[model samples]
Target: MKDTNKHQGLRNQLAKQLEEKGITDKNVLEAIKRIPRHLFLDSGFEDFAYQDKAFPIAAGQTISQPFTVAFQTQLLQVKKDDKILEIGTGSGYQTAVLVALGAKVYSVERQNELFKITSALLPKMGIRPKHLSFGDGYKGLPNYAPFDSIIVTAGAPIIPKPLMAQLKIGGRLVIPLGEGEQIMTMLIRKNETQFEKHEFGEFRFVPLLEDKN
Candidate 1:
């Protein structure tokens, strides 16, 4: 809960490193510099929090690598108050970043453990997403459909049709597609039946699971 000057300095360095690595979005970079990443990790990993690496979190998930988060955020091209649907809430670090950039996020976490923990933790850190749900990500939150943007934080074997159907026209869906090493893919909704696809190279992520309570 304590974001010390030392932590601030580390975040500054992390932001600079991300910029050098081609993360050019100033809002995304500012979000990285402001959110206390160390707070999302276990105390033992605090020293490693700002290293541009993923570290283990609860429920057998890893907080996403910083570069991956920034890259995806940049791809979303988030605007203030944009309604975003995030497929995995993991450590809530990515959720916090989206919030920092002024998006109203509705995040779904498949793991109940992560769901409960993050639902409580985020507000404590003053990062409030619009909603947090424990459910299958493939189904998405149809009740809150037509999001301004959608981000999937896990590796998907195929793009879930429901997610595609739920996007607003001109919305962006950033997902990691594949099994072992995923291709970071972004789909921009062009019309009712068409999407513009782009891939941003490879990344490793835990599989996006389905059919769990």
Candidate 2:
């Protein structure tokens, strides 16, 4: 399936709905409009791609709802060329949005199935992140520390300390913290030992997985 005018129109409607729901970032809205969300899902679910709801994808994960993607991205306040570390590649929909906003993204996917599929799919769609690693999200990418921002796509029981340490001073970390139902939380590194925290209500997400082997 290809991205047609109909898909674009549906995306426009979705963006409008998100704006009404309080997504005020123009860049985030535009990225929502521009990226072909349909292309990120299975062919059978392509018709539901532009809706403001999440849909099931490979590896028992769901492609995040469009509004959730926009909301998290809006909180990050992504700037062009910002070095962003994404904790879950999932369907690569969020990765595409970050790329559309001109961030050099380094994403990690614990599910090897998703990592392989998305790593290949993204380049085909011309959305190339700086790095895509199939590993535990808990450890993060220490080699590429000091990111401008970090986004955790899955819900975490607790904020991973490694992700917090990977941010540059004043960098933001947007994560959904909890088990069952998560409270969207944002942390801004203030100094060597201080981080300002803010919560943005609740959201449902697949659990952040760790490599046990």
How high is the CA lDDT of each candidate model? 0.96, 0.94
lDDT of 2 by residue, 1-213 (tens): 488888889989999999999999999999999999989888998878888899999989999999999999999999999999999999999999999999999999999898999988988988888999999999999999889999999999999999999999999999999999999999999999999999999999999987788
List clash counts for every candidate, in order. 0, 0
Question: What are the TM-scores, per candidate, against the unseen true structure?
Answer: 0.99, 0.98
- Name the best candidate (by lDDT): 1
lDDT of 1: 0.96
Compute the lDDT of residue 180 as modeled in candidate 1.
100
Span of 10 residues, lowest total lDDT, candidate 1: 204-213
TM-score of 2: 0.98
* Range of the 10 consecutive residues with the lowest summed lDDT in candidate 2: 1-10
- In candidate 1, stretches whose alpha carbon ends up further than 4 angstroms from where it belongs are none
